[model samples]
Target: MPAFSVMGEFEVIQRYFANSGRARKDTLIGVGDDGAVLQLREGYDLVVTTDTMVAGTHFFPDVDPRALGHKLVAVNISDLAAMGAEPAWLSLAMTLPKVEDPWLAAFADAFSETADYYDCQLVGGDTTRGPMTFTVVAKGQVPHGKMLTRRGAKVGDFIYVTGTLGDAGLGLRLCQGQVEVSKKHSAHILQRFHYPTARLAIGQALRTVASSAMDLSDGLYSDIQHLMHRSAVGASLDIERLPLSQALKDSCDRSTALALALSGGEDYELLFTVPESKKSMLDVLLSPYGVPVTCIGRITGAAGKLELRAGNEPFAYEHRGFEHFEK
Candidate 1:
């Protein structure tokens, strides 16, 4: 049997989360207070985002505590990155079945490490006994009038995405025993699922160049559709131009790989549009960042029309992206 903590909520917070090391200079009041106080930078706009990860819904119950902690913070930061903002501070609200010291220690360590890596400080949070879930509220900053959004794509803009897609969805399948891959390729795909790297640098680089942008959390098909809806434009994606990783290509057949790339979620890559005139500069500007940016489509004048074409022929795909309430 696992040992449970007898400490009260305040003691738990003090023991695990109230460390001064997690506090940033901008944080006037961190953990243990009723609320956190932070000083925002001058001439910058604040971007706040929150994401929840629930046991069974968002992750397996037996998942590593460290990876879960990392993901809990990462997904929230990805939203800030989508807006070309620099992550500044975060608050966590965690609901655990019970308090186990060793488990809490591992989770807190990993969580702090990830926050520190992004230069984000933990300001305030709450802990409670309930189903296992985590809600992270993250705040970031962008220069005044330069925050990216999903409402600026134009008819002649070029659509591009950073990094390859579908590996995480494949990784999920491998974890669930629905598919199999060679031992050599399993680790790469699995890591892609469990440890997604937010495209922060790419987002920061495209602040001035991208007309509209969003992080790919709900797969390219659904996410780009959202961007189109927001921008009031249409698009035509070339099926052959979609990027795929070697592990994905080798693990599945061409059609299956393409399907995953189209509708697979949780890749956490950035999808943005640049004006046709700036196309030449896009690659050159992002080349120094070392993240692959591939132009997959073009915005069109036909509003609400999104088509996937394969060399001038219209292609059909039945599966849409993940929906929270699908029957």
Candidate 2:
């Protein structure tokens, strides 16, 4: 193997990340500074969220650097989206096993691309040598008193989800070789897993409409339970109403697809509730965005109880979703 020189911390930052992304007007001080100075728009409240992804846990150890970079930023932005905030700035703390210039370049390029696409600027961060891990801190802005929260759902609200579900979960299984799919289907599923899209537009649009909201990171079953718990309400979900991509349906049986949709995590789609009074206006309001929104359930008065039904028959689910500390 050819010998490679390890880049010092400052050298790595200047070479790969200092000038990697576009500048933002709100960023008073950006990369290369001790800390970022940001200008918050008047009447807007800041929303900040952080997420960490570790190799062999959140992703495969051999995952492409570019995809990893995109996912690192996307997941954090998803949190902002769920709160009806517009992504504005990002900070990344990354740990790598080695300092490979080519790998770092690819990662930074994709990371910068993702930031620019979302109109977010990379303000500041740190790097170190350790296991392959990424911690992204994202900042967003939402109009005062308009941000959605997980605690706002009320009884008689309608539960809805943006975009299709379960593709990413199936994609993970395909990557691990636990399931078989055709080449075309595999490509789509893998893309879903590798480049999960944050539903930022839908979230922003629903700020005034949604009663409660959250991004689906821990599978619908687990995430919806979170919303119910936070809002002190119950839900009655229609399993038949869950959305599945054509690719997912083609790759798995109905039962298998439904199971994946329920328990598969990391979809990053928005799961929200809207008052029944506003249901008639949903189509008119959301049609312009072109994102598919499905009403999957209804909020109930029974706090903390979630029921699943399939065509009027009670349904039972075995898997609750991915739990980090399950014994």
Candidate 3:
């Protein structure tokens, strides 16, 4: 008999995940429930998002379970951050081929700790035996009618992104053995890939100033299209203005770094636009977040089209971002 079979599903949940994370007052009924009963704060809009990760597809089969757990929470929390929401509740559904006690313990510890770091409570989840996969449903709250979205970008809004890009992409390449890096930089790159941070504070601050916003899950090349499409606007991306880390710059040539920044995906950074009127106060407003912001482009009047430029001259590239069902 398999080791996992020794413990029934209910027992596994109680042992590993039932008491994970904080106990939020808003969660009237949490684990051990047919359904979680949650209370929404008055005058707030409920923001919900879901993400899933498959072992072989999303991560290496032998990757650290602790890092995987943190990544799972960070990615889902990033969506809530993009919407300028305060993360409140999380429900996870885990499918595993087999449960190893040590792996489960490490993963649960990291998951619970990460959830608490973000002030989120794990309300409920399901466990089952199957292929290695994990799914999380994150719930957040934003002030009524003040949530930032990708639909309000105006024709002259300046496109901005939080934090440096392309590091996570390089990190992915390093993990796949596609690139070699100095020992000094390898650890930083690997951590960026394994442990991503959700811009929760910056996102909430953006609600008042940003005309439009979304998190970078797919590469910027692909994600910008979605924002532009939703807002019914076009964009002009300045290749020169993209932010790259010193490590990324040292690891590869300018062009390779640019390509990664453009379409490598999984950065989990915030991509947003601010109207011209808000430009002056933007820096002052976002100073508290302590994360760097870069102006990469501006919204254009040309609907359904994206123009790329390197300072003054026109630039062209055709790299698509990560997508599941592309032929």
Candidate 4:
């Protein structure tokens, strides 16, 4: 028997899985040990990403476990999605206070669904006793010559983004009860927050064509600026051209909607750059993917600056997006 409801998965692992001396080819040694060893392959370039979701930090304490699982896994996949890598496997390390069968079932189901959708496998994990925290380490692979990166962007490349933005931010506002949303539009915003789709296919396809690429985990304003800064170039984005969701517009005015789309974070879409010459053909290739790819702006010669055009003057805002430490 255990106290305070349950012993938790961590306790089970600490008792059994840890230092059990399980030695597979993939793991030279695991558990009940000082450290774990990894077997690195030579032909395929390994893509690695890790993300942590904490209670009340990344997610609400009262969210659905299935959706929580989906979000946790999707965010990790989104990192590989940015690199145009094919997801292969994942390892989960989770901490929780008790064992909730319903929650675990739903979470596992959602996790399996996402992994299967990407043809990835969940190979290993560890559990612990504590406040709820979920960490996923996702592994992906890219060919020897084909991997997209942020450093390949050029001054004359056309900037593009897949799908709409700001819905997730709006969704967060709704979840926090910070914004008033009508019954008619509540579902859309809620879905955006609960289930953000990772644009993996688009990223893989663009790996060969896109000069530079990244996922818009943050706001477009901040993410685009990051690419500009890294590539040693500047950008001129058309404020009018940003894809504003109707869900946002129905809740707030146009200006507010534009600001959210521009600066609101966690859209999980891809922001990439392609040469001007490939623009037309790329558009045709992207159309069949059923996700809208919009050319919102162009890169410029000036480095480390971002200029937005809203009418004749520069589009100004105090801050453009979310920073992990900023309040």
Candidate 5:
């Protein structure tokens, strides 16, 4: 029998999830209460994002619990970052087959570590018995009228993405045994996939400069369509200008690497657009964040279309990217 199998739900929660290290002073009532009582900052707009990970669909049955914990918090924080918000609180709901003390302890510790890194408090949550699945509801705040969105792009805006793309896609391939990589490159690739950084500082910095913005949870080819649709614009992506990491380049053919950059999901990097006038100062604006921002495309007058180009030559690309459901 498992060590924690004899413990009841409340006991498990009290021992593992309650009184987390990330507790905030503004949280009037936290984990022990029926609901959380949090004081929202005055003169600020509240932002919220939620994400769920199921064992079979999102990860392998034997994936590391600690990495899973950090990824959960980071991905939701990435959403808040895309909206130019500062993370404030989190609520976790878990469905588990059983409570294994070692696994639960590692998972909760890492979860609290990431939440605390963002200065967010775990205010309240629920636990239940079922197939393993984790859901996080993250709350944040942004200055009034300063939250970024996907609705502000215009024709002539320059499209940019932070950090490198496709590394996580390549990492997924490594995990699935679909590719072979040098030992030195494998760790970097896997880290990119399992522990993505939320570009909060860069996103906050862009609130004043970007015409429109969002984080790339889905592949660029799929997620950029949201920005185009909301802003009623099209885009021309320069294939040769896509940002790719050295690990990604070394792992696959050029075409394959670029394809992954376009089609892979969970990079958790910010994608935003700048007007022509602001392009001159883009580097100066984002330099403090230490994330390389690449201009690989431009919003175009051709509404609703994504045009791919290799320099001046128009190129065709596979029209599919990662999507939850397909007909």
Candidate 6:
């Protein structure tokens, strides 16, 4: 009889998860190659998304490791949310400077909590020794015939968003020590920056109704610009209609606060457009989801044009939100 031997990493993975739940009818190939093969589920479209966060660029060096871990996972979940998909699985690839037990413990605890909350599980991942960086690839499932896209917006659609805008942007400003955080608003701003809840439920609920949707990871202005460009339509957002957190307004004036809400980044809220007829139904349906849906603008018939209305007059923004290379 031959002695039994243990398999290596690749072999072990193949033996276990090769044909597992992660590989359903939608999966053409599960393992054993440089890349896995997948097919769009029949009647059901696939929604795939990826996000990366570097130590210095996306996050602070000395911040809470647990929150960082949760955010790394949650933000990616937000992308799936934007597509109105039910998150099914995720793969994590992490680069670490060193494996510190306490840090890993906290990070794993937070990661598990977040994944569990969203009913997502980690099916595949890899670890490497290097500077701190984390990347996630999340897979989501939507109804067979419905998946929201950025290019589907039609003129006269009502532009809406989940939750208040600009909190994360305000949080970042406070984090950088640029803006002073009042005693009353300090915790709110810090919490907004440390942990952002992805509007997963709202996204799913809007699938059949929303024409276009995206997460505001950058800022409302830039991300909306993306939606407008993809849809081949222009938009005019009413500044007065933009939602603001009481904490944010308490810290700054109306103009500055509005600008921050418009152009500040890292909000991770869902910006979606729905038909005017769907408004009342959406409002009643989404009330229990613990997220607010606010209509801030409307899509235009014209193409390649964007407008912003501040009070009675239009205002020109100096910058169109955050850009990586621009600064």
Candidate 2 vs candidate 4: the TM-score winner is 2
**Model 4 lDDT, full chain set:** 0.78
TM-score of each: 0.95, 0.95, 0.96, 0.86, 0.95, 0.85
Q: Give me the displacement of residue 242 in model 2, in angstroms.
A: 0.4
Scored against the true structure, residue 269 in model 4 reaches a CA lDDT of 91
**Better candidate number, 1 or 4, judged by lDDT:** 1
* 4 or 5, greater by lDDT: 5
lDDT of each: 0.86, 0.89, 0.90, 0.78, 0.88, 0.78
TM-score of 4: 0.86
The CA lDDT at 251 in model 2 is 96
Q: Which predicted model would earn the best TM-score?
A: 3
- Per residue, candidate 5 scores C-alpha lDDT tens digits across 81-183 of 9999989999998889988889999999998899889898888777877898989999999999999999999999999999999998888777887789899
Please give, for residues 1-327, the per-residue lDDT of candidate 2 as tens digits. Answer: 122236665566777887555688889988776788999999999999999988888887778999998999899999999999999999988788898778889999999999888899988887787888889999999999999999999999999999999999898888777789888788889999999999999999898789999999889998898999999999999999999999999999998899789988889999999998888888888999989999999999999998999979999878756542222
Model 3: CA > 4 A from native: 1-6, 322-327
lDDT comparison, 2 vs 3, better candidate: 3
**For residues 1-327, could you state the per-residue lDDT of candidate 4 as single tens digits?**
232236544454454333322223554544334444555456669899999988877888888987898888888888899899977777778788776767776777777676767766565676766899989998788887788888888888998888888888888887776788888889988888788888999999897689999998778988887788788999888888888777787899887788778877889999999998787779677767899888888899989888888756788766645533223
Q: How much is the lDDT of residue 304 in candidate 3?
A: 84
Question: What is candidate 1's TM-score against the reference?
Answer: 0.95
Query: Model 4: which ten-residue window has the lowest total lDDT?
Result: 15-24
lDDT of 4 at 9: 45
Give the local distance difference test score of model 1: 0.86
Candidate 3 TM-score over all chains jointly: 0.96
lDDT of 5 at 305: 93
| Per-residue lDDT of 132 in model 1 | 90
